[model samples]
Target: MNHDTSSEQYILVTGSGQVLAVSDTAQSLIPHISPLLPDLINGAGEDTVLLNGRTYQIHRHLLKSESGESYGLLISLQQTSAVQSSDPRLGAIALALSDKLEINHVLENVVRFAMDLLNADAGALPIYDPDTDRLLPGHLVNLPVDLIVPVIGQRRGLMWQIVHQGSSILIADYADHPAALPELVQVGVRSLLATPIIYGKTPLGILAMYRLRNEPFSESDRELLQAIARQTAIALQNARLYQRAIRNADERFALYQASIEIGATLDLEQLYQVIYRATTRLVSHQRFVIAIPTENRMVEYVHIVTPTGRQAPQQVPLHCGLAGYVLRFGVSLRLSGAQALPEPAVQLLPEIEGELADGSLLAAPLIVGDRIIGALLVWSNHHDAYTMADLNALELLAATVAVALHNAFRFAQIQSQAITDNLTGLANRRHFLQVLHQEMERNRRYHTPVSIAMIDVDHFKQINDTFGHIAGDYVLREIARRCRQQLRDVDVLARYGGEEFGLILPETTYEQALKATERLRTVLATTPIMIDGRQINPTISIGVASFHPTVYPDPSSLIADADRALYLAKQQGRNRVCGVQELTNDAQP
Candidate 1:
């Protein structure tokens, strides 16, 4: 294909390495490049070619689209002098740096490569950790690794000057320089040359070379180091991209499994634990919490876990901390350093014990439809301890949590309809049976006592006949409510049938069950339920049966024992409590 060769030499090829277009200058050298195309496409950099007895350097330039798609390749040629352009080792250094994918390995190799390029006795390339906003002295060649890495913000240093001036520093004798560390001088460092390694606007670190002998570095040495610095920047950036891609793949797989786990869990507390565990896989965090908004403009901490264990959950004002802030406004927050965080979030987290405010905190809102239900928060006790990738992972998990929470609430509503009495708001007979069987099984394992009480209203047919079924229905609902108020929370109360209620008092002895039943009879007989401008007194009789080690074989046999006691109570006197041994206690009717 024909191309614009008037301005410069350019040979454009398709992404598949096939020659597609050529500039006018490139047309004359087509035959020379045909053989080298395969190697050039496979990451080969530059080569020399003889055209008309004159030497030229042909560099491979990868042409990429705006979205980073490999659009094509451009082979550009330029005349090269006999003296050669820059050091040939720079190409080998770049190739070596690019060959490694691990970021730490790439950085370590870059330090040794820098020393080889500048011919220095020692070299150091300290990488910047964004989380701590500090340089880490991880990679060094013959230099002490314990030295605190110099940064641009730390004034009165050689790195600061190099970073600010955007030029290299060549020191002939570094024995008494103010910017030089006394420790370096004591370690036999006499000469030094340094340049900043930057990728775009971000300063990665300073590439420093040290010499034991006092040999001055020339301008050519500085130029060579700068060229290698540029190559180092490209290699570091590419390595980071490769590492990030790998982390993202692992995160996506983890999140996919999290979605399924969260969705299947009907228990809200279990779901919270699942979500918190899932988040730990995707982000580095010392603490994780789930908070929801309470009715009184307060944020309730339902789930809070730290490195030690769970922190006591409590409620705080809506403007108290980051969780409330994220839940209120439905926004994600990544907080670290002095960069402005909201006033309320910056406030010390007194409510969340063992959480330090000095570190970083990231929060994301759990939203379902247009409403923000709650927030998920992760905290680290170090400055700049989180990244954008961590926040993104949190947001994704929040979305999964939101959907799961919504489904759980909906499922609960439907399940309630299946197992709840509409009139009394108590467990229906079916649910009661299930609970009974479960409690019996638990007692078998724990060897705990179990007692069941059955109650029936006396003369209920007469009241329904006189006051109509509506009045009877109202009194039955009131009885259910009163029983629920008096019983322990562990007691399972249910509507057994019309005018009948069943109560399972687990972990209770025979005497304790009888006393509770007696109390129930007193409550119904002593207090008059006001209804329709009339005080209606509805008394009741109760029967108590304790599970025996040998007598009662199962839940069905236990129910039969309780029913026998109920018949005995009715025969002795209504408004009385009776047990399986025919022990009766009378209540004033």
Candidate 2:
């Protein structure tokens, strides 16, 4: 039962409102202030002692230790104030009413009690809008229901100050507070109290009370209002959290429905569009891009869709962009806002038109067959706007989309295989002819030189006759594999028919073709075929033919020229490349 009378002006407690020791003066003043202790503690602002007809504002200080524990102090003012007659039982009644009410119910009663406690003719309880993150006076207890006051941005008034500063404001005279108007005073709100609704030190909102006459709020009234303000904080916190959860759940359900609709698509492009739409709908975004890897460890942006409903056909390289990093790292990259993005990322997306148009971006990797084949980048126009639920849902959708892409690729591969040689795993005769025609057309158009080589395994039929056809087949397969290993990726190797293979080399001349054919013949001669623990020597005869547009204009004629050279090699004891001249000179009628 002690108080600090050094200065009963401000209460700054850093600990949990505990008193360690008191001085003799504090102990002595304790007796005089004990009766009014509850009210003084509950008051919203500066402490004031009422004596005669004058008013004074007293300061109290409270402080919290570094460990977050709080302690209290009391100070007495040099001046004394007059008493403003009000209900003495109002504090106890407000507490009693709030004890029986839940968060919302208690908030309603608190607003009502605020009117009675402060002797206000009208009062209002503003709902804090979580979306706008502002206090909007939409609910009221006594004031006109249509008096909409927005407590956000520039419109932030007394209510905003209390919530933002986490402190209470007591206006003894409305005229003194710059924001107070004569209308508020005329409406019986001569004095005003704005107490912050706080939960665990964080401010949720403010509970404001007003009086009608040219009077100030009592210390006792402030004490009662503070308790009510704390209770209101709890209520608002619960209501806001409940509202957020409901909204998030509803959005998830919508995404779930859209996912089902999109799941029916077997096409990769369609699936990507579906995922993009669902993601943009559930979470706000301006642009979306998908980058898939091409040959040579390079990634190409195959799809780019904007929320503004525009699609671009140009592809982007994944070497210096955020999307590229996502593809390279195979992890999510969440940028806080556009400011957090790297300079290179901003510069690389310059052609994107509209600021790359988003503040937050989420990039997710698409993994299939133990490899990250691509990545999805989604952009949002708000900072830290995406939630854990949004990320989880996107990851699930990404998994599905990856599977769809894999299926599409497999279908394409199957279609390609329809014209491929299954035995030697090379292009079949039909595919070879089609490819030869295409290569010829390309050579003619570009005026690029090309060389064709027709190779035949020497005594292949004799090997099948001596050994079984299975051994012959094994030899053919091994030779095809060697030819593929020697040729560049651009070179085409095809099984022309039984025991015959043809290679179409682009960007090559006659001399290079002859040297390459000789190497092929030597490789087969040196590398022995191991079958059933038996090493069998294999050799090949090759015929080289160089395409000259004027000489061999047609693909069939070019192939025949190479075939005739191969026949000449066979006549001259196979296992050598017979150039075109060898065939013409050796053919004597």
Top of the candidates by TM-score: 1
lDDT of 2 at 332: 72
Candidate 1: C-alpha lDDT? 0.77
* Model 2: residues with Cα > 4 Å off, grouped in runs: 1-167, 171-192, 200-203, 208-228, 251-255, 297-299, 342-350, 353-358, 368-370, 381-389, 416-589
> Local error of candidate 2 at 39, Å?
38
Which number leads on lDDT?
1
Q: Residue by residue across 187-289, what tens digits does model 2's lDDT show?
A: 5566777677676665556677766666778777677677666545544543444444455556668667765866677666676677677766666777777
Query: Residues 88-176, candidate 1, lDDT per residue (tens digit)?
Result: 77667755764665778877887787777677899877676655555667578887667655342354467656656767888888987
lDDT over C-alpha atoms for residue 573 of model 2: 91
Cα distance off (Å), candidate 1, residue 16: 17
RMSD vs true structure, all candidates: 8.1, 18.5
